[model samples]
Target: MPVHRQPGPTAGATSQLWPSGGRHLWPSGESSEVQSHARGHLVYAANGVLAVHTERGTSIVPANRVAWTPAGFTHQHRAHGDTDMRIVFLAPSLARLVPDRPVVFLASGLVREVLLALTGPRSYDPAVPDYSRPARSRLLRVLVEELSEAPEQPLHLPEPQDDRLRAIARLLHETPADSSTLAELGKAVGAGSRTLSRLFHDELGMTFYEWRTQLRVHHALVLLAEGHDTTRTATACGWANPSSFIAAFTDIIGTTPGRYRSGRVVQDQIVVAQDQEQGSDRP
Candidate 1:
C-alpha cells in the first residue's frame, strides 16, 4: 500500500524573498512523492532516512547527511516505514553554494543549527533582520565547506561487470531476497557454480554470496526509505527472518538495518532502494 501525505509549507515564507525553499518533518511511517518545478533544493536528513531518485541515480540520505538536488529534477521523499525523518529544503541560490552533484555532508554543530532555523516557523519572517543575515551567510559558508570536504569513502556499492555476471547481477538486483543458490544462479546464467563464483569475485571484488548479500542490503534500504517496516523489508529482501537480516545488516553496515534506514547510523545510508513494484510480484 502506498502511503501518501501533503507537501509541507515552503520554508519561511521568506522563501519567496529568495528563490524557493521548504522544510518538513516526515514522521516514522510517513511519505510524500514530489515532482520538482523550477526550484532546486538541498535536503538535510536530521533523524531519519531520506531517499532521492532522479535521472542521475538513486541516493539514500541518512541522519546528519545532506543531499543536493539541482533545479528541475524530479524526485520523491519519504521516511523509512518504521523510522521518522526531518528534512530542510533550500533554494537553488543557497544550494549552488554547496555541491553541483548529489553528495552527503557531515553535519557540523553550526550546520545543524542552520537547518533547524530554516525549518523553524520564525524563518518565514520577511523583515530583513540584521541578526538573521549573518546567520544565513554563515550557514551558506558551512554548506560550501562541507561540500568541498565530502568524504572519499562513500557508502555505495558498484555494479558488476561481465555479461554473464551482469545478467546474474541484474537478477539479484531485481530480487535481492531471492534465495537461489550459486548452482541455481549459474544454471540460470548457463555457467557452473565454480565459474560463477570466480567471475563474481574477479569482477565485483566479492564472492557470489557476498555480492548477493550486499545487493540484498542495498535493496532493503530502498524499502525502508519507502516507509516499509523492518519485517516487511526483511521479507522483501529475502532474509529468512528479521533477526538474520538484522545480524547481516549490522555486520556489513556497522549498524542495524533499522538504524541505518532511519538515518540514526553514523554513516551515509549506503543501502539503496531498488525499483519496487517490478519485483514484488516475483515468486
Candidate 2:
C-alpha cells in the first residue's frame, strides 16, 4: 500500500526545459542571469536568498519567499552565498492568481513538499494541470491567503514628503555616498540647516543622518543585484571602505554584501555565461 514516485526528468529532457522552464537545483557556487522576454513567471526561493531588482525597487527574497513577477519586468535573480536553491518556473496561466508583488511567506512543511513536487517531471504532464494536483491546489490556497495578509514587518524604507525634505531625498537618491552634512545639504537644497532638520523630523520621522543611511543601503542593494562585488559596490555607493559597506548592509539587509555577491556568483555560474555564448554561436 505504499505510494511510488516516478523518476524525474532525464538529463536530455531537462536540457529542453532550459531557456524557458524547468526545476533547477543549484548547489553552492552555481549561478545564472536571465532576461524575461515573455510573461514573468512565479518563482519561489526554496532555500537561501534570491535577490531581485527592477527600476521601481530592489528586494531580497529570503528562503520560503514567493515572488510574482508580471510579464516583462526586466529583473535579475540570483541565489545568496554558499546556499543551495531549488527554483521552478510556473506557467503564465497559473501566475495570474498572485499579485504582481514580491512576498516572503512562512513556508509550512506541506508547502515545502508541494514546492519539491513542482520541480519533478509530474509538473510537465500536458494532461495534468499544475493546479489540478492536490498538493499544488493546497499551495495555491495558502499563497492567496498569505498575500491577503499584511506583512509582519513591512520592508520599505520610509521616504520624506515635505518640500525641503524632498530636496534632501532627491540629493540622497542621486548621490547616496555624498558625505554632505545637514547644513551643506540644506544650503544646496535652499533651506536652512535647522529648517531642514525640522522638516526631516516632521516628514520622514527620522533624523537626516538616519534617512541618508537608509538611502545609501538601498542604493548599495541595487548595485549588488546588478552583479557588482562588495568592494566595488561599496566604493561606488560612497562608503569610506568595504567594512563600512558591510556593516551598513548587514544592519539593513540582515546579510553582508560579500554573502550577497557569493549568491549571485553561484547563479551566474549555473545560467548566464554559457547561455550567452551558445546564443552568440547560434548565428
Predicted structure with the largest TM-score when compared to the true one: 1
Which lDDT tens digits does candidate 2 get at residues 125-218? Answer: 5554444456665665564454445232223345455667767777777888789899998788788899888887876567877767766766
The C-alpha lDDT values of all candidates are 0.60, 0.56
TM-score of each: 0.57, 0.51
Candidate 2: Cα lDDT at 7: 36
* Model 1 global lDDT (CA atoms, 0 to 1): 0.60
Candidate 1: 10-residue stretch with minimal lDDT: 11-20
Q: Which whole-number lDDT from 0 to 100 does residue 68 have in model 2? A: 52
**Tens-digit lDDT track of model 1 for 1-283:** 1112333432211121222235555554455556775655666665556666665445556554566666777766655533333344555556666555555565544456666565544444444332355666666566556555654213234455577887887787777778989999889989999888888777656787776776687677667666678999899999999999999877755568777655566443322212233367677
Model 1 ranges off by over 4 Å:
1-20, 26-34, 37-40, 82-99, 106-110, 125-131, 152-174, 179-215, 219-248, 251-254, 257-283
List CA RMSD, all candidates: 11.5, 13.5
